[model samples]
Target: MTRRSATLAVAGALIVALVAVASFFNLPYVVYSPGPVEDTLGEWNGQQVIRVDGADTFPTEGVLDLTTVGVTSADAELDLLTALRAWLDPDRAVVPRELVYPEGTTAEQSRQQNAAMLANSQQNAEVAALRKLGYDVPEKVVVDAVVEGAPADGVLEPGDVVVSVDGTPVAAPEDVVDAVTAHEPGETVQFVVDRDGEQLTEDITTIAADDDGRALVGFQPTPGFDLPVDIQIGIDDRIGGPSAGMIFAVAIYDTLTPGALLDGKHIAGTGEITADGEVGPIGGIQQKIAAANHDGAELFLAPASNCDEAVEGNNGDMRVVPVETLDDAVTTIESFVAGDTEDLASCPAS
Candidate 1:
């Protein structure tokens, strides 16, 4: 062969090798895609998704779905080609790795945090649902976390339900903090807690807080409450997050109420719900919208903060309703079922 032709062939081979290597080069980004939409009123693995005891659950119709986003695990490596595809795809999202998994965080640590959040979200959902039904749920202080090398490290543990502090009954977390702050640094404070149905009292020394010149027990406490009825959510262990809290609360309320709230319409939504029924924003709003659309949902309830993404990423005919709280969601559903869409809040398209 001619020398010129031989050089051209070599150059072509080099180009092909470069493209192949680029296809396998891992990127430091994660991809978000549409996931499955699980109907909370339906069944999973031959069992009902939401089961209630100690109360008469009424028969309900229609769908109350919790939408989820398929996210790449923090430990999973993404290639350049996949990231490029996700960027170009309107239904998918490409996010920075650090945004999804913070620096110095391991995959196991992230999973454990998600699991803990899921547990707390379930408890909060129950509280919200019961309170919406006119049930009184008094809050109590519970130990959420213990700091290492702190005064309450070995003395207090997570899941310990605090009943009183310094011989005074503590009803709220702030009360516990106030009781501790009344003492001087290095002074011992008595704490009465119920651990796994057993009452125990322990004295822990107080430490000085760095932010304020107040005494602290070196433990994080959160508000908790007892439920009148037992509520069980039968979701897969792989799905762990607080994003489904709002949907879970709605499903529980529907199951306990007299009639069907959905009126045989398919609806899907995602948001973090607080005990006071506030709906909080979550990540991957676009992917969640796609999942609901793919599931044939006629209406999608999105957090008010996510209206921009929801409006931009919506490609189907499903109406995206903006909701700020659990009460807002229930009212929207009722109005939609009654065929009154003029008064409902919808995502504005600019």
Candidate 2:
């Protein structure tokens, strides 16, 4: 072959390699996709609580005691790319995607996503079911912190209505999630909140730094609630992650109560647990069930909406309980604990 032709071929191969690398790293803005239609149970105390049975409330810690958890922060595009790369290839080339976040994303977005993913997952569904008996629902907020390193350390707190972040006003909860996640951690962000009778301004530090050496602040601007049953609810769009909080609440309550909620049986679940006992469906239910199976849970409690995904993703060794109302969850737990037929049926499909 001619030298010129050989050179041209080499150039073509190089071009292809570059394109592959770029595609691997290139993160793009996903079209704004809204999740399931949440039927608004409406405004009592500015909370949108879906009244279901069997869910109970839990208490809150003075400061978030999350020594056992891990956290990361980045714009939406960056985060999505990070996940994709991890799923695709964790050790090879870091994808070349530009850090593009959903328009108007902020720190609040990261906090909410993380909270939803982690905190609520650790909670007990039966304890969450307790919220219904008291007629209480989850509270939504836009927070602005007025203090730091103390009780009001983060600007976003319980009962703060977030209007804008760093001058970007978000209209929906996802918007807030997207916005807060747009920045690197450790960046002090200004949040404008409508707190009760007046407007307040608060700044929260971003998450701790990642391996990339980006700044991160390990704080979430969440709202916690005090229930009639000595339970508390902690929720915030500012601390986006997952629903481990609700799960943690339930687990703690179960451990502290007389009989064990696990009943010497293994169980697993995934969902966003609101302070008001609402169990909202989450993404990747199939992955979560696989996680449960790995953990050896005999039963898997999943949101009714995500039941199909959980069943399809599961290996079928575990019984899947699709819970809707807090009451339904409690009944299931009681039945499981007593090893007796509570004569309970599955929650009505959402």
Best candidate, lDDT: 1
Cα lDDT tens digits for candidate 1, 90-182: 889988998889988788988998998888888888999999999888888999999999988998889899999989999988999889999
lDDT string for model 2 (50-88, tens) is 232244433222111111111223443434445554545
- Please report, in order, the local distance difference test score of every candidate based on alpha carbons: 0.89, 0.48
**What's each prediction's TM-score?**
0.90, 0.44
Looking at model 2, residue 308 earns an lDDT score of: 65
Supply every candidate's count of residue pairs whose N, Cα or C atoms clash at under 3 angstroms. Answer: 0, 92
Worst 10 residues of 2 by lDDT: 32-41
Error of 1 at 304 (Å): 0.8
